[model samples]
Target chain A: MRKGFRTVSGLTAALAVTAGVGVTTAFAATTTTSVDFQTHGFPTVAAQAAIPAGQGATIKAGDATVTIPTGTFSDPVEFELLEGPLSSFAANAPSGQTPVFDFAFKVVDQKTGAIVMKFQKPVMFSLTNTDVNANSMYYNIAPTGTYTLNPVKATISGDTLQHAIAGAPVGWVVTSPATSVAQTTSPITGLPFADWLFVGAALMIGGGVLIAVRRKVS
Target chain B: MRFAGRSRKQLLRSLLLVGGGALMIAGALEIGRIPLAYLRVARAEQTTVSKPLVKVQIVAPPPAKVVSYSVNALYPPAAAPGHQPVTGSLMGRLEIPKLGISAPVTQGTALSILAVSVGHLSSSVLPGEVGTTVLAAHDVTYFHHIDELAPGDTLTVRTSQGVFTYKVVSHQVISVGTNVPNTPYPSLVLETCYPLDALQLVNQRYVVRAVLVASHLTPSSAANQ
Candidate 1:
């Protein structure tokens, strides 16, 4: 009995060590800055701000928000957010996909008068509209002046579609697949094979008439 | 003789009418059945089997620093760098112990590749990497029973680089056009055609998302080399 008890204790200790290690490993992988910010949507021509390099800002306009993290810029930048039709913000939108919303997030160097296309760190861009979901994808304007599918997936939480990007000062559009109008019925009629059935009936009737006529002659 | 001929004619007309009517009825029923089958299949597409949770012991890898809420951290770049596998080349084997699934994983999702084994999207990152690894197979084949898997079920992939184990986080039946998001951490995505028993192709897919929970490097592997 004493030997059995020792074995049990040893097992317990081993299990405890394993559990502790698992917890520590998971915690380490998840360490991140737990910074949170809130903003409400409002109608504006554009939300532009001269944000300092050391501080971040969350700019919101017309159901869209751009959250620039701290240290995203090395110098004071003039950031502008515009939300409107795709034509207003982008040179061309994707042809076959239905556009959900269009937003252009741009940042400019206050000193050099140059557009800041890339950031030092990633920034969060989200569109909060009831229509957006996993089915919706993000397309950004390319250098060739056409929108292309951003390889990154947009994470969907409830009604919002969000993605993290390191490059900006470009037009982004969220679009869903155009609903396909499938041909549920045949071209001739609502009833499938209607014409074929009529043809079969006609042939059968003709066959019966011929058989009856032959029988009478015989 | 005339009366006999008249009787024969009458019999033939009756037979013709009855047979024609029966044929028309059958055709109508078939026409109606096709649409109903489509409706039934749509419902089946939405259905997912819920199974009892299975507990399995896992030895997780040593902690590696992971960034949270970033594009590079979550999604791998579209143009993956490295010596890409030739089309139809075997990448590795994927296994789900709970479901007793062990299938060869091929490099691409082309018809020829999926015909024999599971296909890994060439654009996605490799297994055990920080980004999402997407694997897909036909529902009629290797992944037929994946719907039976519950959350927390373990999935493992054995490659030359390492043995990566993932835990099931969620299952979703999404439209074919819907994009499965790249998770914030290392993840595995299994996809199959939806409505497992449908005779015709469907516009939906069954997606299983799993997060990497444990992994160990293969000894003297190419990664080590």
Candidate 2:
């Protein structure tokens, strides 16, 4: 479902309005969209600006900046940029990827009332790095129904993650792709020794109870 | 001392108590074996031996579109073309020659799967791939002796994809959430609950990292024969 980008306070009302618009109307519009950032426990900072077809616009959210080049979109669009903490997606992260920063970008067609997934030309997106790994790589959460980290070729120039993208509606994550494994959960819940102790206790108690019952019957 | 003077109930009760006590002691001994084994072989000593870097030859599989949040949804289908594996499906067998461990490795790290066999973390690259392939098991079972695996020891993995040999590079016992350091080479990481003999849940994990030293792909191995 597509909803016009709004501030954190108005996010709920906007989503409610979109839900009321029904499926047919929503599909008739562009289907390209990102999950509501606030809904997913992401930081509540979003910026939106309308860029007419054949024109370019620059939008900034927090320390991140996005530049849409002229003729990048064949249609007039409203650019949306949202920023949040990378740790929010820790559980969903691809193994071995330690994410330090996160961003979500979406493009909505102004006239068609739909989100834009592809671009006529590429756009430049950059973020002023904060505690980002120097050896980190750019990855986008592929909407393949799972949280797949697709490496995006990017360069770091003195505390910045700058990269070019062919489309919007991407969940951009910067992660250090080192480490063969990160064991987050404890693996041993059932120990053989513990099981044995329980078994022995049960046997001893059962035997003692039977001996007492026999003496009473006699 | 006289069995003729003892009643049937008394005899039965004595047998049960003695039998249960013996069984409990046996269980304690089983748990004691883990620490004893560790003492015989020292905790992984950091060796400074410089081994030649082995070239990674196996081409990593193309990025599969499988991404899942649930434990059951994590695994890719077992050697099936264009299919995702079901959780607990057999992926391969892991062998540690030094420790005499040969255990089946399953796909996902579900408790049910780890209780019986080594479980592969779903998000890692498969064995012999360019990235790290992570496998884990319960310390009570396949990984009880992992602490005895010192640097320079060799371990082999046989999979449908190929046969791979990795040399142990380092071992560390870290807090549960700390990440295993990234390596520039193709690596394999084995993890189990720490303190191997802990009778209850622990907050640390024992990790063993190894680099790929040799590999024999299925096609090449078959052709050589």
Candidate 3:
């Protein structure tokens, strides 16, 4: 009886140790950040200033709001402010074959701290005009290199005008606030915690069986 | 006493069970590790701009440098009523009948644009123009069967201005430093990374060259004629 009790206790202790290790390792490997934008359209310069690396930011303007999760930017970035009708600017005016509003901005590099690259490429934004009187505006920029934007977490509140990036689709609606888009990632890539836990459980069961068989034979 | 007195068969079974468990764990780890590596490589490739296989200076051909050829004579440069300068917009649709490929042609080679449709190099001339209209796309997706194209294959491009058809002149697989031949007449160049089956970063490109054969303005534009 004593021997059996000792073996059971030993196996329990071993199982506990493995379970604790697996849980700790899993948590250490995963990191996440969520940002909520309470406003619609572009974020104000003052609001942009408060955004930190790997932190979420919510842009709320009127009834429209956009939520951007942390890790979207590899480094700190400043948003170029634009007000009034977007088409008023000759440069921002729609031209060429596609008559979509095109905007340009520079991503200020946090390191060496210079504006290393200019995002002159037009990022297509879909506008949902719920209010006919509301002025329409869009701020589009693709920040490459150190100021890389995570397209996965980047989303908007409007009808999707076009699908851009791998996961994030560009949405369009004149409405103030809507669930424009969302991004999903593979949980396995973060950490195979479930697999590790399974392995630990298997080991405990296998060890228990071996001990029981050995004791019975003796 | 647990193993010393045991039969050989029992001992062997115990050893096999332990070995099998270890192998299972190792296999699981390997399976989980490989996908992570592939994801890393794919992400890196998309983010970094890979050097072009051909080293031709990207120059926007002057508007006045028109090429006079028998083919151009057939499709006179009438005023394409709605023709506008290419500005990274959807210029047209590219179709290779033999390959049964039809994809939208956009104005820029930005990754965001290329992710959805073929990108027309902004520096290159537009279709029906007097220079090369360069187009690029991903190998594994839209242009996977590009290798199947041969001399004499037909490529048709439809734009807001007009519809242009071309005949394949030749194909080349060149390294990043090689220069694509410059022809005096309007041509079409389709480019993608070489080794269609490769999953790693490719250093060479498969380029298909085709010369203009026919062209016609869109019906609305033709009405102005």
Best by DockQ: 2
Ranking by lDDT: 2, 1, 3
Evaluated against the true structure, the overall lDDT of model 1 is 0.56
List model 2 lDDT by residue over A8-122, tens digit each: 2232222211112111001122343344545543444467788888999888754568888899887887776765534355446666666555667656787776666556666
Per-model TM-score (chain A alone): 0.56, 0.58, 0.29
- For residues A75-99, what per-residue lDDT tens digits would candidate 1 score against the true structure? 8988877544232222254544665
Q: List the residue pairs that clash in candidate 1.
A: none
Encode model 1's per-residue lDDT on B34-131: one tens digit a residue. Answer: 45533533332233112111111122321222211111211221111124466666667788999777777767777656655677776666676645
Model 2, position A8: C-alpha lDDT score? 24
List candidate 1 segments past 4 Å from native: A1-218, B1-82, B219-225
- Pitting candidate 1 against candidate 3, the one with the higher DockQ is 1
Off by over 4 Å in 3: A1-218, B1-88, B219-225
Instruction: Please state the CAPRI-style docking class of candidate 2.
Output: incorrect
Q: How many pairs collide in each candidate, listed in order?
A: 0, 7, 29
- In CAPRI terms, where does candidate 1 land? incorrect
Model 2: per-residue Cα lDDT over B1-225, one tens digit each: 566556765776676666656655655665565465334223211110122212223333422211110011111111111122456667677889988887777678886677566777876666765446788877766788899998889998777656888888778888877766443234688988878877667888888888776767566423322
> What would the TM-score be for candidate 1 when compared with the true structure?
0.37
Candidate 1 positional error at B191, Å: 0.2
